[model samples]
Target: MASSPLKTICIYGAGALGGAIAAKLATGLGEQVTVSVVARGAHLEAIRAQGLRLWEAGADRPLVARMTATDNAAELPPQDLVITGLKGHQLTAAAPGIAGLLHSGTRVAMILNGVPWWYFHRDRQSGHAERQIEELDPNGELWRRIGPERVIGCVAYQGAEVINPGEVELSNNGRFILGEPSGENSVDIEAIATLLREAGVNISISPRIRDEIWSKLMGNAAFNPISALTRALMSDIMQNPALAAMVGDVMNEVKAVAESLGARIAISVEERLERSRQIGPVRTSTLQDLLAGKPLEITPLVGAVVSLAKLTGISTPTSATILALVTQLDRENMRAAE
Candidate 1:
């Protein structure tokens, strides 16, 4: 007899990224894989009541998967893979609740932006190994609860958002890079990659996932905070030579830190900035968070780099200054919200 296929995979934070992945899996993988989503508030109700609505490629479509939406995680079964699409800060809030959903062999793929909580674990030569990012992790709850060994790093390049409750709009780019902490090609990693690739995501199993993480981080560290602080789109920020130059300085400092950690970025600062420019006018998620009145994820995105610089004996003056400014900005924003 044939073996039973992978039964259940949950997209824990079923926002834009989660919705897209769920819809694709429900469509392509069908009975071979079971897709469930975990969400809250109107989004959760919408998915439960009306199924998930996806808008992509200039067409509106809906896929009704065997989804479960609950603010609680104990209600769900142990999952084969739990794809976490929450922002770094949001993960902290939900970590305890979601801990029960993981079995011993479960792979928790973190699809967040900036530096993940597990960054230093995979980085053998990084001086910051075993050092916790207090600003991001806060109380070391995530590092303690989840542990780095269970993590599979994912760098999401897709741009998407929820157009309405239970509905998502895919803007462009649906690529996801996956790798293990030890950079080995394992069966579990490939299985997860296969599911994602079948779901229309450009999934690549990278040998040097740290390089990809830093490459993406180079753009995020500059563009995200700058966009949030200035309230400008990508094209507008890149067009202003002075502002663009300021971003370049931050990138230079970050590159130095990466090199010191033994992960040298192949692209120059200017080339990376140009790549952002070519993406045209786009509002980063940090800017979106500010507008949405959500907490700014500055610590993981910027502060982690600054902390890593200190560990590696490198100076990140530019990143340090920008981080300070963004922290103040986030504080004021939080006060206003209160």
Candidate 2:
């Protein structure tokens, strides 16, 4: 496949994942492709004042990537590619601004957790697909605005966190798996994959992105909410045999739902749980969001699985219970913040 030249790339929501991506792209692809970031508050200020400072997963020194930084999306030029690092819950709100970065040839790559709004867009079957997950996309704003034609499905396996303003610490350096919403290979998709690879990001272009989504979601659906409710890291939860069993149950339910939807998750539940234990004292993204007083990515992470269970007519009692508990925790967290 011939690789097309990438003129410009913009990363929306330059937090952990976005910042880590920006750092690599700006530093590794310097002058090869134009890199810019859309961030806000002190992080934006620091990026503007200084370059993005990134401590790569296992490095002694941090790397500084100087690139364009702005809070105003309107200020950015039309991009060849726009990678949205915002959580599923945050996408609709940021949809309009994200739209401004698009041109006719631009591709929007979403690298977030759990089920995406585009899950059923082209990957739909007769009675199983959802036209709208109201919990994830209220009022169909993202669907109407961004549309599914321009989407590039990306599953980011990497774990990173913004330790402070203008700085990101990568805890895991995993491959980014990408595919088209319609599950077709294209020159544009190949181009984006090549660009990321050139920029030192481990990348894979999947034939069935949904399978990849579920592969990651199975773990996220179990780990994230459990960590939030228990206020524990992956290590802490796995240390307790009872908690580990519960996590296993949640994962099994999710696997059932995924297989019902015709998505194959090759990894066994035991393997996923074991991997979680090996990750050590890592805080799940949901826990981090709760601790920061930010909105929870609950709907897509856990609620989506429960919704799928209903669609598949499968009973997910354990998943439902955990979803209920976590949803309330999120509601209370939001209420208290207000």
Candidate 3:
């Protein structure tokens, strides 16, 4: 059979992660693939004016790339692949616009953290079959609009930050773990993986994406909130005796919930904390948001886990207590902005 024609790919929410991916696709693959970026505000304006810039340490100059950039989803053609780099809290508001860019065959790869909204969808034994996580999705709007069939679960490890309007500085050259929602194989997902790998992204396919998700969540559920509350880096948070003990409590609770849902996290709490310490001082995304006065992603990151714990009859005292404080902090920050 002949090879399929080149397909169009769009990176919605062209912030740090999406901008880096867009720059790679537009420059790395060039004419082999059509790439578009969806961005807004000053970043979109900057991209339109001078293209996207990537700053790397020890580089002679910044890497620059150009492609179709737009804020309105209606202005762009339907995409064969849409990778959403938006934070968990931004997904619902952007869902309709994302839906507008999808053709019937379009596949959406969600590169985000914490407990996903689709956690209960494919796990029949998780007590809630096909039930939407209201804490994450809020009335099933995203579930009804995007549909789980179009989803490709992902765990993104690469770290990047927007230094300015159109410039992104990559902090880590990490891999993206991709999987289908049903935990099965498909040609469409392979095509997506190939496209990303060709664009210079380290990509891997996982049979149990949820297991990987839970494993990653073990860190997020413990570290992110602690970072935000104490305004401390991962190293300091994990090294502290009291904080480390709290993290252990939170991780155990989250682990029980994950095991109840048939997803096993092999890594021990101490191992996860030790690995984090080895990475040196690192500020989490939740802490960054709190500092920037942006809305914290409470629902998916911490609240959803607590919700799952309750549904499964497991107690998450440490996680719940931290979630309450951080959530209150978020509300106060939002109110102050208003």
**Candidates' TM-scores?**
0.94, 0.96, 0.95
lDDT of 2 by residue, 103-188 (tens): 88888999978988878877753244547777788888888888778899999888888899999999877779999877788888
Backbone clashes in model 1, listed as residue pairs: none
Model 1 misplaced regions, further than 4 Å: 1-5, 60-66
For 1-338, candidate 1 gives per-residue lDDT tens digits of 12334578888888888888887777777677777778889988988888888777566555555466776787889988888989887988888866877888888998878878787775676655666677777798888888888889999888887778888887785789998877889888888887777667789998778888888888889999999999999899999999899889888888887788778689998888778778877788899889988899887789989988887788888889889999999999999999
lDDT of candidate 3 over 1-338, digit per residue (tens) = 12334479899998988888889888888778889999999999999999999875446688898988999988999898898989899998999999998898998899889888776667654666677788788888779888888899999887677889999887767788998877778888888787778878899998888889989888888888889999998888878999888888888888888988778788987787678768667778888888888998888878988988888888888889999999999999899988
Best by TM-score: 2
TM-score of 3: 0.95
How does model 1 fare in lDDT? 0.82
Worst 10 residues of 2 by lDDT: 123-132
Residue 269 of model 3 has an lDDT of 76
CA lDDT, every model vs. true structure:
0.82, 0.88, 0.85
lDDT of 3 at 3: 38
On the 0 to 100 scale, the lDDT of residue 44 in model 3 is 98
Poorly placed runs, candidate 2 (over 4 Å): 1-3, 124-130
